[model samples]
Target: MTTSPTAPAYIHVLIVDDHQMVIEGVKTLLQGEADIQVAAQASNGPEALRLLPLYPEISVAILDLNMPQMSGVELSRAIHATYPQIRILALSMFHDYSSVTEVLEAGGSGYLLKNTNKAELCAAIRQVAAGHTFFSQEVGTTLLANLVIPANFDRTRDAHPAELTGREREVLQLIAREYSNSHIAKALFISERTVETHRKNILTKTNSKSVVGLIQYALRYKLIL
Candidate 1:
């Protein structure tokens, strides 16, 4: 018997920002990706909510945190409540820990700075669409420097790299160094599949969604020199 072809994963995204120029810029950046499509665009939070129902294929929403009328935080919560299946990725110029925490707590699946590069932004959207979180490296570092860890917190037992195994830490450090999966696999004498498995495990163990977050945790707790 002949098997049917697998369906392609839909990665429709909605861009919500107050500025048309920002929307246009993001659209231009995303134009090269075949798998990712801009399902809709909105200038404000209310318009975003209105447009969302029309784009049922939108798996992710890229939101600007400083939009007028409805902020990204509020939009994130509304999206989470109304369309819990759609993941929210917050975009902003703010580098403060409070802003990042606010977005995440408001149900954002990932966060990126406005100045993020094209590759990182696209990667972040895909990651969040796949039910994983992502954060820009700069944002991660800022959060690490400003975030307050409780005095009672133990790195070994806490939600950071302290919970990771030695092998996982090695993988994380490689990740921090910007090593690709193939490179990591080759360096560690492991298969690419195994490397990917280690990556996922590290993310879960550290409660981190991206390499940036993992690296920040490592630096914050002195897990690596």
Candidate 2:
């Protein structure tokens, strides 16, 4: 059976980017779609905050890093705290573990590379709006490879042992050593699907939105180290 595209009752979106060209281009594309509407545009994080409360129907917010006055991560945290319902999608050029981790830690629902195709960008927005986390293939690949955090913060492991179950910890050690899920599962005598399930549980218990965060949590508390 062919499924129909879900039409939002009303889609109010806010685009926060520094370049005029990007803002207009995204607006042109989204506003032309059937039900999605470009409700507002902001050049920087400050403007995004000022505009957000005014546009209550905003289902998704696409944010760009390197904006003046405030970085996207800073703005994302504020919005997440106050407007928990709005899905935050980060569009940025930095693809390394550190950069993606910041957005995830700030509570973004998804992360996309700036070079992501228009179709994938649109799909990511819809995915987040439907409450499923989304990530670019590049981002996801890198996430599984590296995870690092500042030297200070306590991992608060006591608050989240479910993520670091004995089996998960074993898997995480191999992951920290940069082993692929397949390799880890085979070496550990488990199926890849079981490995994936453990990975999912780790993310859930640690409140990690991505594989990188899962690794960071694993490393921080010495589970992987």
Candidate 3:
């Protein structure tokens, strides 16, 4: 008799924020997700750090940006330095370029606005947990508006345009436009798995570390306006 295939492991998460209400809100939003678990919670950076060692199964950390003792950026940096395996997803009210950039620079894998709905929040957590990046639409817009490519940059010389297939290019364009995988799949009349494959190929061809990098690449190559 053949044994059944093993199920995928749960995506354990750690929620960190100074405000108890915010933590409770996140937990409530995540209650319906069967595959995602709130493995632990902490009110500050130090508490979060202390809890990490205890919960070795935690794969993601949702951090609030403006905590008193240690800011989200600082916590992100510290967590990245020590627990590189734990992907960080920053939650903040501010959609400004500086705040978003700070989280990315500090090694955060995703950024979500505090006002994000349950669907987007869960999607972002899953994306970051899978070693991919996600950002709120407003945050993406802010990044695109502020990120300036060099005036003298040569796309023909610098970008590997020849490496990307036509389908990959299409995916990249939609991605720069902030379309989700499901939306991209629907638009292209392809399965989400196919879209994901194209996404991976696009990132590999462009050497993009995250969505931010992919957007910058698109801008540099004039793939999107």
The number of the candidate with the highest TM-score is 3
Best candidate (score: lDDT):
3
Badly placed stretches (over 4 Å) of model 1 are 1-8, 153-225
Kindly list the per-residue Cα lDDT of model 1 for residues 132-203, writing each as its tens digit.
Answer: 557788876777786555556566677444567767777775665445688778778888999999999876
Q: How far is candidate 1 from the true structure (C-alpha RMSD, Å)?
A: 9.5
Residue 186 lDDT in candidate 2: 70
Distance from true position, residue 134, model 3, in Å? 0.3
The residue pairs that clash in candidate 3, if any, are: none
Candidate 2 Cα errors over 4 Å, as ranges: 1-8, 147-212, 215-225
Q: How do the residues 1-225 of candidate 3 rate in per-residue lDDT, one tens digit apiece?
A: 112112236899999999999999999999989999999999999999999999999989999999989999999999988987788999999988888878877878788999999999998888777655678888877877875545554667655543677787777766754456887888788899999999988876666767877765665556753
1 against 3, candidate with superior lDDT:
3
Each prediction's Cα lDDT score? Answer: 0.77, 0.73, 0.81
Which window of ten consecutive residues has the lowest lDDT sum in model 2? 1-10
Which model, 1 or 2, shows the larger TM-score?
1
Q: Deviation in angstroms for 131 in model 2? A: 0.7
Question: Model 2 Cα displacement at 206 (Å)?
Answer: 9.7
Q: Which pairs clash in model 1?
A: none
